[model samples]
Target: MAEKTLAGKTVEVTGEGYLVNKEDWSKEIAAELAKEDGIDLTEKHYEVLDYLRKEQAAGTTLTIRKVGKSGITDIKGLYQLFPGGPLKLSSKYAGIPKPASCV
Candidate 1:
């Protein structure tokens, strides 16, 4: 896992590839998080993140195939964006506050 300072706090990567902290975040924080991952928070990214978060919250898991079905075509391209793959990257980078088992 990787660690970095974001917004003056320590952001630690968890098993799911997301930075976990004891703070609740707003939409702006989510955008800032995407920037940390070098991902531009476009509509597509936001949509996917939103869906993934909702799914995780609802006790479901996602996969690259699901991501592609969600309207993202370039799974291979995401390798550079998220070395741990879409599940980790999206779950982590989206700042979804949930446990891996919850998904």
Candidate 2:
């Protein structure tokens, strides 16, 4: 685990940077995380992140295939929106646990 400050608040995170405590999350933290990844959050990005957060909160397993069915973005669109590791990056920004499908 590791601790970092974002928006003047300290939060713990996994070594891979997933939030350790979901309750420590905030839109400010999401913005900060996105900036670090060189992503400028737009409505499209929020659509995916918001959906991921809601799904995780409901204890649903997150997967690339599942995200595609979300109607927010298809697999290709999600990759284009997040780049690199789409699910990993979006999940982190959403402040949810790293999806089991990740890594």
My TM-score estimates for the predictions, one after another, are 0.58, 0.94
Candidate 1 lDDT tens digits, 1-103: 6776665656675654455653444456667676766776666666667777777677667666566666554666555445545666666656765444434
TM-score of 1: 0.58
Question: In terms of TM-score, which candidate is strongest?
Answer: 2
Q: After superposing candidate 2, which stretches have Cα over 4 Å from the reference?
A: none
| lDDT for each residue of candidate 2 in 19-91, tens digit (9 for 90 to 100) | 9998998888998998998998888898898999899889898999999999999999999999999999999
Cα error of candidate 2 at position 29, Å = 0.4
Per-residue lDDT of 12 in model 1: 74
Once fitted onto the true fold, the runs of candidate 1 whose alpha carbons sit more than 4 angstroms away are: 1-23, 71-84, 97-103
